[model samples]
Target: MHEKHKSHQVSGAHKWLKRSVAHKMFDRVPVVPDNFTIGETNDFLKTHIHEFETINYIYITDDTKKLKGILSVKDLFRKNPDVPVLLQAHQDLVVIYPETEQREAASLALRHNIKAVPVVDHEGKFLGAVTGDQILEILNREFREDVLRKAGIRRSHMMMDNILEIPLWTGIVHRLPWLLVGLGGGIVAAGLIARFEEILATNLILAAFIPLIVYIADAVGTQLEAFVIRDFSISRKLNFGKYFLKQFILVGTIGLILGGLIATVTNVLYPDSRIAFIIGIAVLGAVLSSLLTGLLIPFLFRNLRLDPANASGPIATILQDILSILIYFAIASRLLS
Candidate 1:
């Protein structure tokens, strides 16, 4: 009788609250009162264990249903059954409110190294437990959602299992919006490339290296975007400037190494031409440009109250492509022409 699964089906208006810990919680979790002797509790579970969703941890409450402490099932078995359940329970508890967001609940569960997070009401009354199974589901859903958002797939409803089943128009509506942005960016890139026609004509070899520049820049930017999205998801409140600085130093060092290799390779291939030195500097500039674009775009998106994921794949990659072109030709114009 104590395992009364509360069915607070918050429909329509507050349907979004389905993401809260309350919605995922199992109210049929085994809960005992403060005064139950271990022997009595053992006896009760022996007959009624099938009623509860999980016996991972048994919650204890006072007469008024205020949560007091919790006892692990292992401790329950270790203690003398004649002792009061409260005496065997750990009084120092980690509790979260029913209204806590799913991410926060996951965070709390992780921080405390607990498999289940107990939910309480305003007055600290024991409500229910969001068990390990539910927590796993929450984490899996959030990870997939983050991946889709970062890939600029705007359709949040489509699941991996049914990816092929989504109608053609629905698929395009979600995916094409971001690709259209990329298309506009490509037009701007074409215009930028055309603007440097004089440099390209003077040093035809520079045109040959265009794909190399764009590919390297896009690669660097995609790597940085991975780091940004990871930090944004895990630790939003932590200072981003610190993270970006470490990334800057790391990227700058690698850019120098890669630049040296590009110079060495170019000099080996075209020993007499100033084009070798020119391409090296251009590649270095492209790397740094990519790093800045990757870092700033996500930060800007977050500040604008948008999902940081929207700043990564299409937008960052397109900007890097354009910057790589401008950087490559600007260097060629100065040194090769």
Candidate 2:
């Protein structure tokens, strides 16, 4: 009866832990009581050190188990053994609450450059610490999630321990959604170009520049999307206004240089100042619009609780292609008329 009761309690704890947050991952390492002097700490370590797997920093706590400060093993060894442990302890505590998400707890450790983060209750009582091993696990899980999400795969697929063991149909189902969306987007882009038939037919030269405009716009948007997705994965708090301003400055500069080069080349090859002017202005407009579209699309998806990387790639590319065609034709029609 006693063994059964103990097993039941363990099972109950496990169930409870599953519903909890960062507290569930807490590690119960031995903590040094704040009142212990350096000499006493040394004696305690000599006797009780076997209880711990590894000791990087000694967590100093008060009698009631309230965290006081921390002392590194390096600092402890360098100090006089007769001195109080608190004297050598660093008071700047970096702690996380039990309710914090595991990812957030790991991110905190990373941001602060610490091996582990201490878990505390609302009242500041120390519960346990999140070890470096746990942090590593969380990082690996997050990395896998980002990769799979970017590939347009469902997060539930992470449960499949072996990738090669997954059924062929399951893989196709996961990949087919994005491909279908891209197909629809391609149809829409084709229709958009068809609407500009008169402009393309009137000036065959404009048709030649269409590929150049679309390619440059897609390239610039892809670059911005990759940067934004990576940054958002690590830290969600991005200053959109400032980021947009910076991107605008960057895109504007590049557009001018690229537009000038294209205009110069077009004038030399075609010798039509009107055509050269229209191409240059259209290129500048298409690039600026594409850059803004790339930045905003990811942010919109992120706001909608969608994975920015998954949606940004295909959608941004399609949108850039369509917008570049529209901008290029609109400018040519206006200038050449």
Candidate 3:
């Protein structure tokens, strides 16, 4: 049943939360109480320590199996084996409910450097532990999907066997929406490009490098948005100034070098010095505009209570395309006319 849902291809962060098998697994995770105690923390260590290779700490709970506290193995070593129970050595336990957001739960575990933390129900009963390893696995899977998505690859066909082997009709259903969005955005960009036809006609040479200029800006913006969103997902504060300048300088430098190369190539090919110069300037402007767009749109979306990554995808690309077309034309008009 869950496999069917997992077969659906979802774009952005929605894929992990809405279409992932892990999300389904998490939904059914168990819950336990707080008072659940360890009869012998030592005995649990000796018995189950070999069972789970990554077991870092042992939890002690009550008669009802409600988690009272947790004790690290280091605490066990310091105390005498004859001690009735090691419950006193427990520090303040970190517990999360079953419905806790997966990202939040993972972030807390990473922030605290905990090996695993006990999960609990509303009544504070012991559930299971969310291991750091589990979080690591989730991160790895998500990262792969993110990288693939940036390359414009379809994700549904990649992860789940059920998705990859589905009938052509069912498979097309999953792919159609993303293509529709991309197509709609492309048509809008085409209209913007058409609006700039006068400028292109005045300097026909500029048309040669439109793809290069637009792509450079769009790529830079996408990269910046993804970097910021990923860092934001971690503990780092969103440093606007630092992020802006960092992307500005990096994209600016690369764009300058690339523009110089494009200008040189065009000068050799087209035999028009002024057209080449205009193309170079337009390229540089478009690159900067793109970098700024990449940085601002995500932050803007975040302020508007939206997922920044959503702004990082096809919609942002289309907007960037329109902006790049405008910038390129405006630069060409000024420089050539």
Models 1 onward score TM values of: 0.81, 0.79, 0.64
In order, the Cα lDDT scores of the candidates are 0.80, 0.74, 0.65
Instruction: Write the residue-wise lDDT of candidate 2 on 1-337 in tens digits.
Output: 0011212011223333342335334443547788789988877766766565346677888877788988877778888998999879988999877666677677788888988777777888876677888788887877777666655566666554464887888878877776687788889878877877887788788888889988987787777777777666557688888988898999888889989999999999999998999889988998898665677877888899776766564556777888998888888877777
Q: Who is ahead in TM-score, 1 or 2?
A: 1
Q: State in Å the error of residue 58, model 2.
A: 2.2
lDDT of 3 by residue, 1-337 (tens): 1111222111232344442223422212212123323345556456544344244666555667667767676666677666544345465777776665556566677777776656667787654566666677666766766664554446664454376668888767655666677788788778877877887777666777788888888887777777777766563367778877877889889789878988898899999898788778777888888765677877787778665565666667777888888888777777666
Clashing pairs in 1: none
Residue 320, model 1, lDDT: 89
What TM-score, to 2 decimals, does candidate 2 have? 0.79
Against the true structure, whose lDDT is highest?
1
Measure candidate 3: CA RMSD.
8.1
When 2 and 3 are scored with TM-score, the better candidate is 2
lDDT of 1 by residue, 1-337 (tens): 4744545322221543666777787777778889999988888777778778888998899999999999888778888989999998988988877777787788678879998988887899987888998889888987888777666676464367465888888777777877888899999999998998887777677788889889987888888887776677566585877877888898888788888898889889877448778777888899988766788888888789776777776777788898999888888777754
Q: Each candidate: RMSD to true structure?
A: 3.6, 4.8, 8.1
